[model samples]
Target: MFYPLKFDHKYIEKVWGGRKFENYREDMPEGKIGESWDISAHESEMSVAVNGKLAGKTLKELAEMYPQQILGKDIEIEEFPLLLKFIDAQAQLSIQVHPDDKYAEKYQGESGKNEAWYVIDADEDAYLIIGTEDCTESEFKKAVQNDQINQYVHKVKVEKGDVFFIKAGLLHAIGAGIMLAEVQQSSDTTYRVYDYGRDRGLQLSKALEVIDFQLQSGKRKGLKVCGEDYDYSYYCLNNKFALDIINIKTEYEASGEEDRFYILTAVEGQGKIIWDEQELELSETESVLIPAYCEEYKIKGNLKLMKSYVPDLEKSKSQILSVVE
Candidate 1:
């Protein structure tokens, strides 16, 4: 009864959004479309299936009805664990921070936000605000009060194919002229620290509480494992989720773990996922959910895809370590 599921996009209009998605998508509504939520189960915005027998059913509904088959035996049915999106930034985003799990649960009553970005495209001068320069809590407060926070925030140039992991408590912002795929914990709590004079409230107190001054930003170039027809790499892996990239020259084969579901997002070219005589076409910037019960599948065509899923930490570590050894 289970098959790979595709969901309708949830487009969010933002002041800093752009028309970049027009390059790959035809259904984008006319506006500054900043984010297309590809797969989500957050109470605020859940994804609805748009394919096969599951058409019109929300992600939460499917999880509730078939938790073991949809989310697998390792995940709890209380809420879906991950949020996936493609973001286009026409202007710089507000500098912000997110609370860790313990703090988020006590204050916002939600999961903490830990996110990763895989750059799909970037302009010649595109950049990102990662963390803060070495500064004490008192100095940071002073900078905010004096309208000089920019002097304390660290900036780094970005390019296509770059990867960054933004853990909770790390201040960050996406600069203009960039498009990327983001995989994050399912939460919407952001403590905005600076907004470049936008008419928005600043959550200085909370941001100060969660901002970790010691955190530094860097791109993740994962260890590569070459296959006969493809190359696979693990970008980021934590208790929250694991992010990987697969580049297929001809075709690649994989199987779904009985304990966890997998999300495959196409970042370049096009491909078809074939399994048990069924096939689904995937294009750039689109995502599909491979149900936990899916035994095996073959991705055919020349393409690059980003994969994300909840992980068994110890098992994942061993797999990576085995490669190094």
Candidate 2:
């Protein structure tokens, strides 16, 4: 019998990282903590169960043991379908691009990356680079050679509660003084175009090969305010996954159908998730994995959460549209 399962954080340090992770966990190492992988099963890093009988087990092991229960009956995902992380960018990240699935499989033996970012907070002047202006291959190459890349790069100012959907092959970068939640395919194949004088070998050749020159610049619009009363919003709903933000007032009930499992992250406030005779005290920045086919559950309290899961696009689309209309 599966209940709500929480996972321990896997902290990673980086040159552009800051100390924002201290708000989520107290045992972080003394260094610039860049990201905390909240729920992951990627080969590079994995999360461990933090509660109940499955405590200490890696997410990979749990999925393998209870495939249909944890990942859904129809989810034939090779490993985990999604990777969730909290990123604290004290400084700018490298301007980079990720190949599509076909390109990645042929060259890197991995899946491609299509990610979404939900800005949790941002400094007064924080911004991001999404893509370049319309330019021919020769024009882009010349800009790179002349160290005038910024001239073609598209920059957009960001603020709290903003969201962006970064498709594969788009040249983009997360700017400094921003903290956000990232959801993406479980791949880490990055081809950097620029690193702002970091001296790290740039993947210029590979990045140029995969870059989508026609992709428009700027970030995606904010989450769609689908439902009335501002109780629900649809952040993203695509072939790979669906994400929704729920604003709980007094109590909210969530169903667990057999086709998909839900990963819920409490982004603000405090609450208790109760199901199957088990209850977990959910705090800010904590996450829980509710297995597929598990009993229905109730979230009680005033809080905000991001819910993600594999989705049947056709059926999910109609369902969402009806609610919004």
User: CA lDDT of each candidate?
Assistant: 0.92, 0.84
Pairs in steric clash, model 2: none
Per-candidate TM-score against the hidden true structure: 0.98, 0.94
Q: Indicate which candidate wins on TM-score.
A: 1
**In model 1, which runs have C-alpha deviations exceeding 4 angstroms?**
none
Residue-level error in angstroms, candidate 1, position 181: 0.5
Provide the RMSD of all predictions against the true structure, rounded to 1 decimal.
1.0, 2.0
Task: Estimate the lDDT of model 1.
Answer: 0.92
Worst 10 residues of 2 by lDDT: 221-230
Candidate 1 at 231: error in angstroms? 0.5
Q: Find the number of clashing residue pairs for candidate 1.
A: 0
RMSD versus native structure for model 1: 1.0
lDDT of 2 at 197: 86
lDDT of 1 by residue, 14-35 (tens): 9999999999988999999999
